[model samples]
Target: MKVLITGATGTIGSAILRHCLQEPSITSIVALSRRALPQDISSPKLSTILVSDFANYDAALLSKIASADAAIWAMGTTDANHEVNVIYPHTFFTTFLDARKNSEHRSKRFRYIRINGAFTVSDQDRSLWFFSEPRKLHGMSEARTLELGKQYRDVCQTFVVKPGGVATSGAGVMECAGKLFGDGAVIGAETLGAFVADLVVHGEEEEGAIFNKRMVEKGSALLKGNK
Candidate 1:
């Protein structure tokens, strides 16, 4: 199976790419990026497409993306790069729709897993609302993601991954502190990456499914059985 991965250079996106490379069943991988990919990660099964603007892609590129069996949309702006809460979703949705429109595989289900934090729609719980304060921009950014999820719930499947604090490879002091406190909620980058790959390659019946870190890992394993 061929898969397209956007934002293939980012931490989480790269992790997913690495995991996909190790999967023998995956035939080829197309990575869409603005710049050249790292040389160290090159492989025979991989191809890279340099894209200037993901929000708008030319016809040629669009057609290519449209034909792919599936795409993992991972492009996003961090707080340091862009005013995430206000602008990230606009760019994200525009790119997502463009990808869908360009996809050649008509029935090909696009599995979009948005990385967001824990949030509830209910306002009755004021305590939870505070949790969204410090991360207001991030929270608002995810709201737009949810909007996209609802919009494409019928045409395509969208799942939001709400990880509290991501724990990377080296257990830094911050990560250790988090682990010590009740706020130690975190998912390793590699773990999250493998989880998404398992979902895409082996799980199609999981369409329109929303999953957490734990659920992603579990659902991926379970879906393989039925498939």
Candidate 2:
């Protein structure tokens, strides 16, 4: 299957890309990023596209997107730039859905796995005390994407994954320890990547959003099943 990945150079995204590369079922990958990947990765199945603007997609980019069977949206920022975190993804779903309508793919459901942070309220309209606006924006983003998925249910299947503190090999010793002992609130980057990749390649049959602990459990099961 052909898979398109955004933010392919970020910690979680790079891990997902790695797993996808190792997966025999995935034949092609399109990596879209604002800048080129940090390291040169030589793989016949992998291709990179440098994008200057997330909101705008040129004809060439559109054509590439149309060819993909699934997409993983792992791009995000902590600066509270709602435009980047929220608006861009919503636009991508709309554009991809439009493109899918024109394409002649055999599968009716186009898989879209959106990587979201934990504690993001799906019901954005509800009030909250701490970090209210940012949480609401994040929730709104998920809600909007799910809305689009519902509107195009015949052609689109969206999955929102909410992972807590992500620990990576590159993290400092203290940070890694904190994440490891975070008690179900944290997950390793590799683990998250493998889980998301499995969902993209094998497809997650369960509908709606998935939380961190569930992700870990399901991902572990998938790994064992493969072995």
Candidate 3:
């Protein structure tokens, strides 16, 4: 399966990229970035596309990525603002669907995986103490994607993965703090990467929102299944 992935150069995105490279089931990978991927990474199965703007996609860009069976929006950062969190993904959601409009004959079910945080509150009226703005923005972003997924159920499916305490290699302090606070469970980058990769290659029957608890449970299971 060919997979289109954004933010393939970031931390979580790198983790996801590493696992996608290792998965034999995935035939090819298309990485979207503002710059080229690091020199350390290279593979015949991988191709990188330099994109200047995330909010807008030219016909050439859309056409290039339209063939992908799945897309993983692994973009966004800790201090991600409204444009990065909402506008980018929203634009992408609509643009990708437009990209595939011409290819209806060759269309297969497109699985779109969105990486979201666990504490995100979809309820706009609900109160949050910490990271309220970011959480709400992300929540709002996912809400819109879910709506599109429902609307295009025939041709596409969207799944939001709410992973908690993404413990990356050597990030002791951050990992520890993450685990101790919000989510007690710490999921390593490798495991989380493998988890999402499995979903795109094997495909999931259902889609919506997946919390940290389910992520840990299913991610672990998916990793083992890979072995």
Candidate 4:
């Protein structure tokens, strides 16, 4: 499978990048980011591209990225800033959807997986104790993206992964706490990466929202299977 990944330099994104490279079924990958990836990470199946702006995609660039079989978007803001949270990702989603309309690859399904938070609330009018505004704004992004996917369900499938707390590799303490109090609210970064990579390879029929508990279950199963 050929895949494209954005925000490949981030915490979760980087892990996804590494895992994707390790997937034998993934024959090709494109890493689209604002900056270059780490020098230590290199693979025959991986390619990197730097973008000056997320919202500004020229025809050539859009055409290049639109050819991929799937895209993993990890570019979101902590503050839920309007541009990064909504506009940037939405633009890319629409761009890919539109580009596929006139391309021959329309015969294939395009998978799009976006990283969201476990606390995100899609109901605009819902109440919250803290970070209400930011969650709502992020929710707006999620709702918009999902709506678009619904509209173009014939040719594309979209998924949102909402992880409560992402722990790095060998997060012993975090794992213990999550087992005791998380109720599947937390997951390891490597585990999340494995799940995301599996989605790209075997998620031809999966869609809609994915929660932390589900991801943990799926990811753990995938890691064990690969071993």
lDDT of all predictions, in order shown? Answer: 0.62, 0.79, 0.80, 0.84
How would you encode candidate 2's per-residue C-alpha lDDT over 138-183 as one tens digit per residue? 8778788777778877887888888877877642342345447663
For each candidate in turn, the TM-score is 0.71, 0.87, 0.89, 0.93
Return the lDDT, model 2, position 182: 60
User: What are the per-residue Cα lDDT tens digits for candidate 4 across 1-227?
Assistant: 88999888899998999999998888999998888888988998989888898888888887787678999998777786999999999988888778887887888889889998888888999888999988999888888888988998888888988877899856546656777886456888977898888887877355888888777777877777853
Q: What is the per-residue lDDT of model 3 for residues 65-165, given as tens digits with 9 covering 90 to 100?
A: 87888889999876648888888887888778866866752467788898877767788888888888777878887788889889878778889888876
Who wins the lDDT comparison? 4
* Superposition error at 148 for model 3 (Å): 1.3
Please give me the total number of clashing residue pairs in predicted model 4.
0
Clashing pairs in 4: none
Q: lDDT ranking from best to worst?
A: 4, 3, 2, 1
List candidate 2 segments past 4 Å from native.
123-129, 170-184, 222-227
Judging by TM-score, tell me the better candidate of 2 and 4.
Answer: 4
- Which is better, 2 or 3, measured by lDDT? 3
> Cα RMSD (Å) between model 1 and the true structure?
5.0
Pairwise TM-score winner, candidates 1 and 4: 4
Q: Number of clashing pairs, model 1?
A: 4
Error of 3 at 221 (Å): 3.6
